[model samples]
Target: MHNACLFLGAGCNAIHRMSTLARPACLGLLACLLAAPGCYKVPVTGRAAVNMVSDEAVIKVSQEAFADFKKRYPVTRNRAYDQRVQRIGERLAKVAFWDVPAAEWEFVVLEAPDQINAFAMAGGKVGVFTGLFKIVHNDDQLASVLAHEIAHVAAKHVNERLSQAMAIQGGGLIVSGVMSTTGAGALTSNAVLEAYGLSTGIGATGFDRKKEKEADHIGLIYMARAGYNPEEAPKVIENLEQANAGRAMPPALLSTHPSYPERILQMIDLMPKALEIYRQSSQKQAPQLVK
Candidate 1:
C-alpha cells in the first residue's frame, strides 16, 4: 500500500509540471492573436506604445472601479469644494490632451480625511481625497497635483504596467481579457497585488524615479498650457513633504513614486523650459481675457 501511494504522488507531480509548462505556450498564442495592428502614442513624450486594450474598454473599467471605490469610501458633499476641483480638473484635462486628445474627463473628491492620496485610473477617472485638499492651498497648487495625476492617465501608464505584469507573471491573456469583460474585477485583483507589492516583485515594477520625473516634466507643461503657473509644481512636492514629515510614508507612494528630493531636483532642472511655456501661455491668455 505504501509503494502504491508513492507511485500515485509521483504521477501527480509529473502532471502538475506538464501543466505549468503548457500554460505559457497557450498564453503566448493568445497574446499573438490579441496583438492588433494600431499603435498608441503617449502624450507630451510622443513615445509610441502598442495598443493592446481598447480605450472604451479601459474607460468602462475605470468608471466601474471608481463607482465601487466611491461606494466603499465616503464621497465629500462639499458642493463648493467639489465644483472648485471640477473647474481645476477640467482646465488641466484640456492641457492633458495637448499630447493626447479628447479624453473623457471626470473628477471626484472623496471624504476620506485620513487618506492623503490621489490617483487617476486607466481612463479619465481622477479621485482626490479631502486629506489632499488640506495640503493644496490654491488653484495653481491644485493644478500641480491634477496635472501630475493626469499625466499618468494621458500616458496610459496603468495599462502599460498591467500588460507588463501579465506578461511576466504568466497571466497575460487572462488579465487582458478580464480587464475587458470585468473592469472592476481586474482593478480589484490589481489592488490586492499592489497591497502586497507583488507587481514590483515580479519586475513589473510601477513608476520609478525616471517615470516620476517624466510625469513632472510633462505635467508642468500641461499646467502651463492650462494657464496655471509652472512654478507651482515644485511647491506641491514641498507641501507633500511637509504633510508627511515625521510620519511613515504611504506604502502606495513609496512603492510607486519617486522620493521627494528626487522629484524636486527634476522639477528644478525643468524649470527653465516650464517657465518659458508659462510666459507664452500667459501672453496668449492675457490677450484673450482682455477681449
Candidate 2:
C-alpha cells in the first residue's frame, strides 16, 4: 500500500510541473492571436496604437450606445441649431478623417442644460449639450469644442484608457470571455465609464492632465487646419472656467485633465503656430473654374 501511494504522488507532481510550464506558453499564443496590426498613428505626436477594433466594430458599438443615450436624454430638434453644429462638425471631421479613414461621423446636440459638457465616442459619435452650446456662442467657439473631441477620437484616447484599465485589472478567463463576446468596447467596464464621464445623469468625470493637454495641443492644430481660428481655443477654456464658477467644480482639471489655467497658458503659447496654419489655409484660393 505504501509503495502504490508513492507512485501516485510522483505522477501528480509530474503533471503539475507540466501544467505550470505550459501555462505561459499558452498565454503567449493567445496574446499573439489577440494582437492586431498597427494602423492608426496619432498625428503630430506619431504614437502608434493597435487597431484591435475595426471601424465596423467601433461604429456598431457607438451606434448602440448612442441610441441608448438618446432614449435617456432629450435631443435638440431645432433646425437652425442642428444645422450650425452639422456645418462645423463636417469641416472638422473632414480634417480628422484625413488621418482616420472609415469614420462614420454623426453629430447630435442634446437638450441638456445643467452645465457645459461634450463627448465623442468611438465610431465618430459626438454629443454636445445645449448648456455647452450657450458657452460655445459662435462658430469659432463651437469649432474649438468639436476639434478637441475629434482629437480624442483621432488619438484613440478611449481605447488607450481601456487598455490601461485591463492591464491593471488582471487578465484571465473572464477577460477573454468578455473580449470575445463584446469586442473592445466591453473592456470599458462601468468603473472606467464613470471615470471618463461617459455615463449619463452623472456629472462626468475628467481625465488625467496629460491626456487633456495632449488633446488641447492636437485640437488646436485640427481646428486651424479646418479653417477655424486657433486663437479661439484659449478663449474656450476661459469661457469654461467662467461657466463652471460657483457650480461644484466638475472635477479638478489636473484630476480629470490638465488644470484649466495651465491649459490656457499652453494654448496661448501655441497660438503662433496655430495662427500660421490658419493663415496659410485662408490664403490658399479655391480651385479656379475651367475657362
Candidate 3:
C-alpha cells in the first residue's frame, strides 16, 4: 500500500518498511544495474569509472552556468593578468584537446582579489581569480593551476560526478531535475557549478578527494607536456599552504582535496615521468613573470 518513490516505482512506505536486511540487497541490485552499461576509463590515467550521464547534457548545463557566471562577476581589468591567463591557457588547450575534443576553450580572469580560486567547466570555460596571482609567481606556476583545472574538464569529472549523484539518488531522472532548474537548489544549477569546483550557493565544497588527486596527477603530466617545468607544480601547493597558514578550516579528512603535504609528495613521486616529458618536449619556453 506504500506509494512509489519520486522516480522509482516502489514508494516511500515500501522503502521505509523494507527490512534492514532487504535494503542492502535492493541497493546492491541498483548498483549492478547502474554499473552494467556505464563502465568507461578516465582519460590520461585510464582508471575505470561508471558514468551514466551524457556529455551533451553535462556540457549544455555547463555552458549555461558559465554564461551566468560571466554576468555575475566582473571580468578583470588587469591587462597583464588577462594576457598571461590567455597565453598559458591557449598553450595548455592545444595539448588538452585530444581528451576534450568538443572544447570551445575560453580563458578569463575575474576580478576577485580576495578569492584565490580557479575553475574549469565541462565545455572548456575557465576562470581565475585575481587573488590567485598572489600565489602564482610565474607562468609555469600559473600553468599548474590552469592545467589542473583543465584536467578536471578533460577527464570528464563533472559527468562522472553527476552520474554518481544519479546513481545514489535512485535514477537517471535526477539529472533532468538538476539541469532543468535555473536557481539555487542543491541539485539544480548548483550541481554543475559545484561539480566544476566553484563554491557557489552552497558553502565551500569542491570535488571529491579522488577526483582532486586524479586532476593533480593528470595536470602534472599536462604541464610538463606543454613545456612548463613540472617542478613548479608542487611549488603552487607550497604557496597555497603558506598563504593559508593562519586560516581556520576543516581537517584533511573533511576537505575535498588531499592535504597540501600529500599533494606535494605525490607530485614529487610523479616528477621523474613528468620531467622526462618536459625534457623531450619541443615547446619549452622561458618562464614569464605573472606579477
Candidate 4:
C-alpha cells in the first residue's frame, strides 16, 4: 500500500473486510472522502500527500513547544555562531518563504555542545545545537544543515505526521482542542515536537526515512537556489558519517535519516539539477569558514 493508504488503513481496510461484494462501493465512498480535501503535492518532489490538520493548529503547537524549549535551554552566547546562523538562515528563509508563507521564521542557537542536532518546527521555529558546529566546517555546509531543517517546514511533513497520528488514534478533535490553547498541553506538545524531530525530555526523535530523504531533496535545491554550494550537501553527510565512526549508535542527525551512503548517492544523483540552480542564482555569497 502507498504510505498515505497506510495512514488510512483502519477505514480503508474496514471497507475491504466488510464484504467482497461491498468492496467497490466502500472504496468509492472512502476515496471520495479522502480526495475531497487534505490532498496536496509536496513542493520540490511533488509527492502526493494528505495533511488533514490545519496549518494554524500545527503552527500553534510549534510556537508553544519552541517557547517551552527556550525556557528549558539557554541560547548560545557565541556571537560568531549567532551571526553565521542568522546569515545562512535568512538566505534559506527567503528562498523557502513561498513554500511556507505563514511561517514566522526564527533561528536560534542553543548552548548544547554535546548534542549534534538541529530541527525546524512548522511555522519556522528553528534551533541549532552548538555541537553541530563540530562537523559543519563552512557557511555552505551550515546552509546544508539549515536548509534541510527548513525543508521539513516547506514540505509540511509535521502536519502530515500529526494527521497520521490523529487518524490512527482516532483523536482528531482531542488533538485539535489541545492545540487550540496557550500551552498546547503536554500531549499535543510532545506529538508536535516529535514530529518536528525532537522529544521534550528525550532529546532528538528523528522523522522517518522517507521524510528525511525528502528534506534532503528539497534542502539541496533550496541551498542551491540561495546561492550556497550544493556540493557541500553530500559532504555534510560524509562528515556526519565520519563523526559517527566510533559511536555506539547514530547521532541525532542520522538516527532515522537515510543511511549516509544512501543519502550521498541520492544527493549525487540530484547534483546536476542542483548545480544548474546554483549557476542561475543571483545572490552569490562567499563561503565563510565555520571554524
Go through the candidates in order and give the C-alpha RMSD of each one to the true structure.
9.2, 10.3, 5.5, 6.2
Write candidate 4's Cα lDDT for 1-291 as tens digits: 233355465765564466543443344334335444555678999877666566777788889889998777799999999999998999999999889988889999999988888989888999999999999999999999999999989998887666555444443322223322323343478777777767755634556778889999999999999999999988888888888788786654456767888899999999999999999999877888866
Worst 10 residues of 2 by lDDT: 282-291
Query: What lDDT is reached at residue 261 by model 2?
Result: 86
Itemize residue pairs with steric clashes in candidate 3: 3-11, 4-11, 5-11
TM per model? Answer: 0.71, 0.74, 0.83, 0.83
lDDT of 1 by residue, 179-275 (tens): 3333443444344234222233464445554456777777888888888887777877898899889987766444557788878888888888888
* lDDT, ranked from best to worst: 4, 3, 2, 1
Q: How well is each residue in 1-291 modelled by candidate 2, as lDDT tens digits?
A: 232224344542443455532433333233334443323467766755433333444456556766777676788887777787898899889888877686788899888888478888777888888788667766877888988888887887765544433332444321333332336355433443443567743635545566678788889998888888887778788888887788666555226677778899989988899999988875322322112
**In candidate 4, how many Å is residue 199 off?**
1.4
How does each model score on lDDT? 0.64, 0.66, 0.78, 0.78
Tell me the spans in candidate 3 whose CA falls farther than 4 Å from its real position. 1-36, 171-187
* TM-score head-to-head 1 vs 3, winner: 3
Candidate 2 clashing pairs? 206-256, 207-256, 209-257, 209-258, 253-257
**Collision count of model 4:** 0
lDDT of 2: 0.66
